[model samples]
Target: MEIERSDRPPSRVNWLLRRVMRYFAAPRLNMREDYEKVRRVQRQLAVLPGPRFHALDVEIISADGDHPIPVRVFHPREQRRDEVLLFYHGGGWVTGDIESYTPACATMADLTGCVVASVDYRLAPEHPYPAGLEDCLRVARLLLADPTRAGIEATGEIVLVGDSAGGNLAAVVSQQLRDEGVAGAKRQILLYPVTHWDHDPATSEFASVRNHGDDYRLTNTEVQDYFDLYVPDAAQRKLPTVAPLMATDLTHQPDTLLITAELDLLCDEGEAYGAALERAGNRVRVHRVNGALHGFITLPRFSRSLREAYDVINEFLDERVPGKDAEDAT
Candidate 1:
């Protein structure tokens, strides 16, 4: 069970996190060192318990077969058929992998009755920008082309789910699919997604960045560092795929469910995205998780809130995807 603090006191878990992160603070950092630190933090997620979804590991082969992408697929042990959720893990586009996100993917598969494919996309400062996004799209396309191995039918409804950097990729991939005349994904779920690299408070009017930007798990300094590492080029950051908020067309994008943590710096931009999608004539839902931090989905301390967030997803999928409820009942 996870604790719920209505008072929200900067989240004791997150406060301690801030203290732990201080040790790694430096100007010129090592990529290996950063990955090690994040891996240590991600291991904590293994301590949390949840429903059992049979997990499988396999390489998602791309066309030309130069390099295989690693992916973790979670299928409900009892359910024979379910929708597909292609999940992209978030670590500012640098850290985090399928193992780090196993619990969430397993829970998502079991709870939503969706076969969850948690992609281990390439990271930044090593693979850099577009590499991760490209890997994500390739996995989506390959799975859509033939999902049988993952226990999903070829024609099953697919949804894209991601957090932070992964959310950005999901949004971008949806647009790409739209442009390419692909009609597969029906919905996208974004958790505290980094929608834009350049966010102007005056223009966005999202005060969360100013109010809860610091002392929280995700700070302005760290955010900037992420951009420095992943998107070294300022010009590339403005691209629609890099920053979906800057995208000109959201008309044919999948139905969107954007989740924002009240205390997260990215909250405003995330909320702003929902409105933009709605204005573009797309069905959108933005829910601000009150008194929550950015990475609640992975932290055991926030499991109560995390569970609620999963419930929110359940309800959303029930409404948008259709047939999910019937599958769950069985």
Candidate 2:
């Protein structure tokens, strides 16, 4: 069972976390090293089996013009060419790759009964801002243009799903799709998405001691460090497209499933974005997973909550994609 600190005041949690921060609080932002650490942890977690999904590796072009972005696509146990999903990985836009995110892609494919393509965009402080965004858009367009290449069905719609930084890319790519007047992706799934560069003061109030499970954890400092690596260039902070919360308009985008973590710093932005979408008259579902922190979806064994989180994701997908539940059973 997951422990709950809801009864306690935020100050008490902060005080307790201070003593333990050294062990859990990640180091100062060293984009490369921190990125590597995340990949290593995810690699260890991926070894454990959860659901069955097939995988394949492929390549695409990065916005940097010449660099090739390696990608991995996950196909469900029983799938037709009609269902498709474009997935972007979360690694503070620094270290994550298709391999590091295979477990998640596989899990999503199984749950959603759709083919999932996980993109390996160039990381920040190297490729930086618009570069990664461009890579995401290019791949999405490429996938939609040639459905057969990704085994996408002629009748099915494309869906965009992402976590953390990748969630940011998914949002931008979805918005761009609308802007381009292309209609293919029917919806988007954002997992504890980072919707804004500006960390609202209210959200940061409970920065310390947010754990996905007793074993897998993330502290307030770690969140800030990730942002630093992701948007190292101070100037890019004002761009709303980089952070969806800043987008002038939230309407006309696809129906959205916004997941937020109760103890996470990004929670506020995610919830706020959901509210914005709802206010814009768009269909939206905002879910706050209690006793959880950012990155919980990636750590299933360390915490039962992670697996439980996937249950919510699966349910949401089943609802969005009718007949998914029946297909998953078989």
Candidate 3:
């Protein structure tokens, strides 16, 4: 199958920004020193002043009975939906925290008019694979069990939303919840998620890895570095938890709204995962944001790609049928 393409190209501003990123930001990470550097840089880039929203910080005990996970809850100025969004921030499973993502989460709560709970899961290298994943799962279960615990007056479905590695966690958590025979997330929204384990052009099948991996903000080498840090064991990398696309069973997943960035290395695999879900008879809508890069959601609200993404997200939350405007938009 052909990967979807957009008729429109990147805007002049986006083009210039991509050039700058490629020059300065798109380098393979050094697991030792770069972790802190990346965290600092992400804060600089993502922690901008955003629209005001009520926020609260709370702690949820981990299922392992070991420690408490920090969760930040954001309430929009006007609550328009009863559903709450359980969000997982993306940092290749390593470098992001709730504090670094506050601005983005606040914007999402305001834009979607839904209460947003941002989970601060453990990172890799120090915590590794199951550690972060477990923290996310524990938080999700607690919220699903009782939204009021997080200060949400939710009466509707609890939607799982995440970007990049967080998207990976959400997909796995949804499946695990189904396996447990519990009424878990009924809907999910994934933004440029990391679905597959491999990005090597020599071995991987996705053409996007070969085409856009090196030029955009997220590079194949950088992704490989993240995996090495997150899952040290290569054999475990193929597991369904680590790579959702590798799962043989895709049945009974939540209704999915999958958004991929046109210029991202993970684009094709994300779309492919959506196709697999559709084949398994799940409600799936795949939207490719034209001329957008991975992590575009954290860009300033005025960004064209960011605006288009929110439009798609709000439409999905509202259950509005997609209209034809862009190539393979929905």
Candidate 4:
């Protein structure tokens, strides 16, 4: 499948921004304090607040029956759909939280006309690997069991949505639900998901890692650093739970709308996962945003790439039956 490309040249603003980020925001995996700095930076980046809306924060028990997990529910001004979007924010499993992702969640609810529930799962270097994954799974199961638990009045479908590392969680949770023979999300939207374990250009199978790894907003060094914190055991990184692309069986998963940014290091692997899903006899649609970087979904509402992504996402949500055959849109 051929990915769509923009005829327009890369934005000068983006180029300049990347240069600035390359120097100032470069990952320093030395101390635990460095992670806090990353989180602070993420919070500061969310300057564009969303339109006023009703929001509530709720605490739900974790899957382990031990701790409580925080979830934020956002209600759009006008409701157009009965579905609830279970969102997981991306911060490489370390930085992002409900507060940092509030603007994006609010905008998502308003744009899609679906109540958005953002999961504030446990982060890494403190709660590594399966801890965060467990929190996410517990929330997904609770919502699927009863939508009203999260104040979702509408008893419609529960769609799993996530970007970057959170996208990885959504995919894994969907698969785990299916494996457990429980009700799973009928639809999932993965935005530039981390589907593979390796990001090193020399070792990675995807060309995007080699082509765009160093120059974009998300660098290979930073991603590796995140992985180091999230999963210190390198051998375990290949597990299906960590890297969905490494899964031996991709069958019977949720209907998927996998979107990737053309310049993202994860682009090819995300698209490859979509292809694997299609080959495994699942319904899938893959769209690539040209000239965009990873994490574009959280950009300001006025961002062109952000607008283009939501358009595709909305179209996917509006489909009554997305069809059985996989589609690669240009």
| Model 1 lDDT tens row, 1-330 | 112223333443465676555444432344434656766777676645655558878887755577788888887765534568889988888778887788877767776777888999887878888788889889888777778655455456678999888888899899898889986477899988998875443444568766655556676666667787788897898899888998888897788888888768798888888888989987787777777778787754247667767778887777844673484367
Model 3 TM-score? 0.90
Q: List clashing residue pairs in candidate 1.
A: none
lDDT of each: 0.76, 0.69, 0.86, 0.87
Total backbone collisions for each predicted model: 0, 3, 0, 0
The most accurate candidate by lDDT is 4
Question: Model 1: what TM-score?
Answer: 0.82
Which portions of model 1 miss their true places by more than 4 Å? 1-33, 40-53, 77-81, 149-155, 199-205, 320-330
Off by over 4 Å in 4: 2-21, 24-33, 44-50, 322-330
User: Which is better, 2 or 3, measured by lDDT?
Assistant: 3
In the order shown, what is each candidate's alpha-carbon RMSD?
A: 5.9, 6.3, 5.1, 4.0
Estimate, for each residue in 232-297, the C-alpha lDDT of model 2 and write its tens digit. Answer: 777787687777877887778777888777766676667777888788877787777766667777
lDDT of 3 by residue, 1-330 (tens): 224444576434467776777775457466445888879887786555556668999998888788999999998888898889999999899888898888889889888889899999999889999999999889888888988877777797789999999999999899888888887787899999999998998889999999888777889878988999999999999999999999899998888999999888898999999999998988898988888989998877788888888888898898833442251243
Residue lDDT tens for model 4, 7-39: 466445466776775664344343345888778
Q: 111, model 1: CA deviation in Å? A: 2.7
TM-score of 2: 0.79
Scored by lDDT, model 2 comes in at 0.69
- What C-alpha lDDT does candidate 4 achieve relative to the native structure? 0.87
